[model samples]
Target: MKTPVVYVALQQFCEADAAPRQRLLEAGFEVRQNTLGRRLRREEVPTFLAQADAVIAGVEPYDAEVLAALSKLRCISRCGVGTDSIDVDAAQRRGIAVYTTPDEVTEPVAQLTVAMILALARNFPQHLAASRAGRWEKRTGVLLSEWTVGLIGFGRIGRAVARDLSPFGPRLLVTDPALSSGEAPDGVQRVELAALLAQADVVSLHASRPPHAGALLGRHELASMKPGSYLVNTARGHLVDDAALVEALQSGHLAGAAIDVFATEPYTGALSQMPQVLCTPHVATLTRASRAAMERRAAAHVVEWWTQASCLTPTS
Candidate 1:
């Protein structure tokens, strides 16, 4: 029998941890990593994984055309949540199994969500910039306790954020169409999306990407939010209409926004130049501990599939 080949498609896979490579070698597999320091362009994907049996992937696109060209590729163990980047339906048709490390990202992302909300509320970025420039002024910031915190999605990260917000004693409102009203935990009121928009002083997006729907936070939705209310998106970036968000922030309709992901990554969009926005490089799951854990687990899943579980598609 030939030693199966494994491809590591994530750019930062081994930087935080080297154990994954050792594990693959111990399992009698040949491991190759993405050599390009950045994401591979669309044309560069197919040829890269042509001879591989499995791949530990990042947020790169796996469209139908890309999947069609892979002759030996069979599994993609995603290093993070949100399989939106991969064409799962297409992969399914081609017998290419997909997996993700959903649990590894939950805590780190939830922690950052809380951190962004507090930072925006207290003007942390602005104050730090001003102090650096030798200008000092007292700017009274809003308190989380004084605002109605509305969560759009009630899944793993959303519920985790709610639990983290409990000590602050803010009014909590939640709306997830997938969940019944009775499913809401105590102290969190389940409401309609529109009602939540009208009432929340701070709206944080935690919703998963809905299939075939345009951005959930488009013009109409942003218009419905309370004036001066803030937004924090550590979720999928395509959830918001960037053009709409930029206009809102510029016109002073929305007070500010803190975003970790973007519609297009390596994002050099207009939002990057705005003063009212705080941006991160799609790295809510980039903690050293979380990255190391996720990479190891993702690599393990790939080898596990090759050894004993290729017939069954493992849950991400």
Candidate 2:
């Protein structure tokens, strides 16, 4: 019998470490790594995925067309928590199992969020830039305790961020239509989006990116925010409208913004030119421990599904 082949379409940045590849080999998979040297285009993914028995996918699109092409694909082990990149309904329709490594990424992402909030609150980026330009600038910035933090979604990542922020003593307001007051983490008060928007001195987005066509923060939402309020997004970029955000930042309606993810990745646009805005390559989950944990869990899931084929159907 031929050994089952598992294809890994992880982004190029993810392949630099050898642990995931080695883990797959140790688990007896005939691992076929990236065919394209870079992030695969939409047209390129289905061609390679068609022959794969399983895949560890990145943010590349795996829509109905790609699903139809992957006749042998049993499972899609997502490297991160976000399933916005994958076509979940199409995968379900095709009887393919989908798993996201949410637990692995939660703490790291939460830590990064706290770091960004601190950096923004203290004006660290501006001071650093000024220092680099031979100017010793002493800029007074707002303290975290003086601000109200509005967490847009109270999911695992959001709750983790709230937990980390508890010691800081900022008032915490969370808005998530899916979550009831009882479901909120202790010390977090559930509020309407408008209420959160009006009161929060720093607003952070932590919502899931559903493929649905609507901006989570549009012109009206931005307008609702207090002038000089800060915005931070560790969530998917589309959650906030980039154009509208850029306009708000330019007009000084927003004091500053820190963003990790962008609507279109490898982002180069108007926001990139804004000095007040701090940007990080979508690397909130790139910590050594988190990366290893995610890969290990993803590899283990694939191995378990392959070994227990009779008990677990592709659909499950």
Candidate 3:
């Protein structure tokens, strides 16, 4: 009997922790991992995953065309919480089950969001630049307690951010379709998106990216924000329009911005050149514990699905 193959397409997996990959081996599946140490390009995906019966996926594109090419692929176990990279509807049509480790990444992402808010509030980038250049300069910064923060989504990550920021005493405004009128948590006000944008001193994004929609914060939305306020996004990159944000920063409408995710990764864009912008390489969920947990959960999903499939198949 031929052993079923599971391909690990995540750029970094099971390096510090081997339990996830070990579990796959003990489950009697041959496993393959990306050796390039980077995200696989769209064209390279099919070639690498040609013989895989399942894939432990990353942010690499798995659109309809890619899903159709992986003839043997039966399931995709995502290492983190976003389906933006995958064509979920197409996967369903192709009989491929899609799974994500949503809960495992919540704490890490929330922690990053808080850190970005603090960094921007205190102008960490400007301070660090002067210190690095051997010049002693001090920039006046605002206190979190003095500002009102608007959270764009009320999901697991959004709630976690609210919890962490509550003790800091910032007035919290939340706008989510799920949070109806009079449904907000204690100390949090549920407001419309326009109200939140207008009232917030720090507008943070924790919302899911809508499918096939334009940028959530275009020119009009960015313009509506409180002057000299900050923006933080640890969510999907497409939520904010890059050009619009750049314009806002240039005009001094926004004090600063901290961005972790970008529309195109390995980002070398205008924002990176802006001193006020604190850009991270989408490492919000890259903490050791979070990465290990997410990888294990994703691996377990693949094994569970494969085991069930094997049991259902007729013996030769």
> Which model scores highest in TM-score?
3
Model 2 misplaced regions, further than 4 Å: 12-19, 35-37, 310-316
Tens-digit lDDT string for candidate 2 (59-96): 88888887887789978988899998788999999888
Q: Tens digits of per-residue lDDT for model 3 on 115-141?
A: 999998888988887887898988988
Q: Tens digit of lDDT per residue, candidate 1, span 143-211? A: 789989999999999999999998988899999999897999988999999999999988999998843
Error of 2 at 64 (Å): 1.5
- Ranking of all candidate structures by their lDDT, best first: 3, 1, 2
Task: Write the number of the candidate with greater TM-score, choosing between 1 and 3.
Answer: 3
lDDT values for all models: 0.88, 0.86, 0.93
Give lDDT: candidate 2, residue 174: 98
